[model samples]
Target: MRSPDQRLTSEAKVTAQSMLLDPSNASTNPVENWRACFPEIIGRSPAMIAALETAAKVARSDSSVLIMGESGSGKELFASAIHRLSHRSPQPYIPLNCAAIPENLLESELFGHERGAFTGADKRRIGKFEAASKGTLFLDEIGDMPLALQSKLLRVLQDKKFAPLGGNDLKEADVRVIAATHMNLEAAVQRKSFREDLFYRLNVLPVFVPSLRERSEDIPQMLEHFTEITNSNHSAPSVSFFTDAAIRMLCKYSWPGNVRQLQNLVERMVVLKGGGAISIDDIPSDIIRSIEGQKEQAIVSTGADFQPNFQQASSAMPLAIGGRKQIAIPDQFGVLPEAGIDLTSFIEGLENGLILQALERTNNNRNQAAKLLGLNRTTLVERIKKRRLAVLNEPSKEL
Candidate 1:
């Protein structure tokens, strides 16, 4: 028999592993059950799935999630998904776009102001926190939020309370705040453009929504989806397939604007082409115009305008995606170093990498792992089979 000390040490290690891996330890994956949260969120890309999984994990706890991505990359969509999967799913999910609101009025908008609170004081109004009582309040484009307001937000997040703009009374807010931003808040903090305190508070959990061009494989599905929707309103033919030539044309473009851009293209195609089996000829003039250059003739590459080519020398070593490393893109790409370089085959590699990470962290909690990675449980399973991630079908009861 083993000594008591040895057994105790072994048990402790097992417990730690279980806690880190177990969904039961964290609470049921409410996000798994709440599918409506991502009503508009499209794509089954592994990168996106991994992001959703991380967001769901962050959601279970009351940690404030800082969503980072390029503008129009669907930061708010994931924010909404997190709220819908939280305990506060039944409550309101309020969105405040910091960039859109006037700096002076933001305070009154967040923390209700008393009548005569300001020159334009209307009446006693509830702030976003109060309005989101027991629910989630999403702060969109928080990086653009005024530096003056960041301090107040940090205070409220820390204290769970806020004072109306002109009122002395401190009101209690039971709201869960989830902040989103496109700017590099970390760089912002270093530059002192954003407050350090607020960054830490919001950075407790971070969710990323990858760009559309980042996962071009999802383009085919998204194209079919948009085409199907458009086919309903107007149609000469109820066809489903795109000509290989047309699909090739799409796959080549860089899609700089991401999914919204793709959606725009789809809408344009549907209206302009009058809906049917789309041949390359049926494609729009602007899209046609953009692809006419010799660079576009390659078809495999839409050129640097979309996913600018960059070469990374690190394919030999395993790059950790979920580990504690801050995202850093190589500088050689000549574009924003933050966006990373594109690879012809790296899309497949990314899929494998994300699936492996999700399984590693989730300890095979398909439901929890799926949420951590932002994958549909079914999709995760499909990928597991496709990539063969070696996960348990049933969630381990060890938790």
Candidate 2:
């Protein structure tokens, strides 16, 4: 017979194996057919995997779900996945953006309106709730919904019935609610901007989508996905693969706009570069500057070599400014050399370089150029005047 400790150890090992083998653990048991399961969502980070697992579990039920994440973090995709995984997949999955519609017409949009309900109501129309009676109703930017509408929404949730605008009889609805928002509903409730009761109702099954910055490891996969999309959409100019250095720079970027920004960048590059391999030169100057800034901060923090890694990684890389080779300021023992760097001059040079690049990219369209440089048109004009950049001071043209 085995000793008590040995038997307990064997039992623990069996339990561990069982947990590892569980299909719900996305990290260990990868979903063999993710395309069919989560067609729009893509990522392999621990946070993303955990979120997908939670979404899958919650999809089995008809409970209301509130998805929270940064803007462009793919909350709608999660909402759609939940609907697809649920029993109501065959039914219509209607989506409505609460913030996009005007406050005056939001009620009519949600519950629909009858003929002669209002001055502009020439004919009767069904609302999202009625349209998605047996399916799902995805409410994007739910926190931006007006306080007055929150009460009506709460009533519908409580009774599972609603009346169309200016209607007398109550209509039944069997729709599942999946709301998404980048705003903090709890804070909104505390501020009285959002109803506390309504917040509780919508947040029954909260699923937080991780931002792209949080899952930097997924950048390469996302790049590939976007590239494929770009290629499929256009002919003649096929998508090009990013160089290793370029990929590293992209992975290091803090994507404030999340996946949407990355997708835009990919499409822009694919359109501009035709079919060659994407190098550091293909990247936007703003993005390159941001990456270099991050590297500078890291070097300062670690008191390491001040020389940027990119310089060594791609010696032939063209500088953003007039194709001049980037100046290397050597440091000794974590200290500035006797010939200390001119900080103001360096900043001005960087700014001038970015402005010139933006002007060239936009074909001398001042407004568009200013937007690319994240400056007001007037400010850009003023800078051009200050720097005596006569080339940029030509007649302005709107794009």
Candidate 3:
């Protein structure tokens, strides 16, 4: 049958697929109906599921939707999904980037200009508002629109009518607006850069898309999706898969650039390292440095904080220590001080406190105390003997 190399390759492929497609048990997991609406959106993390649920609910309405997210987090995909699920799915889905056009031409871009209206205007033109009639107009980077343009946009949203530049006739507008911005519009309003009234108008129904770092669980599936798309579109031999170690390192990455960065990495690998499984060595040097740097930083920080942090961590255990001055723990206590602690005394005190609390709760029943502390009865007895702890009674014997 198959050669040993071929069999190994098949097994690796299966393992990669399993790793990428593990089922999630999150309560907000997207159902089949909702998933069907967003076939292009490639994530099943709880954060993604919650966002999908929100988009599905808001899709039925014709109200303005303001999508807030970090750049490259796929705000446009959500906008398209909402339009697809809405009643206006049959109509044109027009999109315009507010930040891309110049200030002088932006007004004309939103609400067409008449022939000879401006120096460059040669013929009559329809803007996004008129072009997106009875459909959805996705305004990307709406936060960057100039103040003058913002006022005109607010008027159109309120009155549903606008006069073409150099034309007096008011044109009736019937368009559903879906705006997306990575900026905090409230902060912009506070700065008096963005119009407060326009912000509220667009924010009637708000949707937030989580960043790649927040939905790290979805990275494997996303990596797989990007790989498949890259292989299919490119003319080179297929970049088949990645090694398990490589995938683990990728998951640990913070992904500051989010999905776009991940996709670019996959495409770069396909072009440079196609035709085989990509090992950890295949990953870019900068990414490896970043992951390693985070690990080192975590280790150093945790080690410095471990003693006091251990106290707080152990406090979360089932049994609370008894009969001590209940002083509030301060934030500064989490850090290691210059004086440092007596390790032996600190450990013994913490252990004794827990044991004493457990024994008190169980009324000096050795077996019960052992159970509470998740220790063997024999082990608990040895500890008590070594510590010379005084037990008042042994009424309940071991079963």
| lDDT tens digits, residue span 264-379, model 2 | 99999987888768888899987787667656752211111132221111113223223334433321213432223323333444465567667767777889999988899999
Question: Model 3's lDDT to the true fold?
Answer: 0.72
Give the residue spans of candidate 1 off by over 4 A: 1-40, 233-241, 284-399
How much lDDT does each candidate structure score?
0.65, 0.72, 0.72
For each candidate in turn, the TM-score is 0.65, 0.67, 0.68
The sequence of per-residue lDDT tens digits that candidate 1 reaches over residues 1-399 is: 111122224443333234334646533554332222243467666776677667656767987888877656788777876675566766777888888888888888899899988787878898888888888888998988988889988888889888998899988989888888766565466457889888888978767678776777778887888778777766655544577889888876656566777777777767776645678887766556655542534332111122221111111122222333322222122333223332322343455556656666766567777888788989878766543335335443224
Model 2 root mean square deviation, Cα atoms = 18.5
- Candidate 3: clashing pairs of residues: none
- Considering lDDT, which of the candidate structures 1 and 2 is the better prediction for this target? 2
Candidate 1 clashes between residue pairs 3 or more apart in a chain or in different chains = 49-373, 49-374, 50-373, 52-374, 53-371, 53-372, 53-373, 53-374, 54-372, 254-306
Q: Where does candidate 3 have its weakest 10-residue lDDT segment?
A: 299-308
Badly placed stretches (over 4 Å) of model 2 are 1-36, 237-239, 298-399
Cα deviation of 170, candidate 2, in Å: 0.4
* Tens-place lDDT digits, model 3, residues 33-148: 34544666888888888888788778778899999776677898888777766777668788899989989988888889899998989999988888888888999999899998
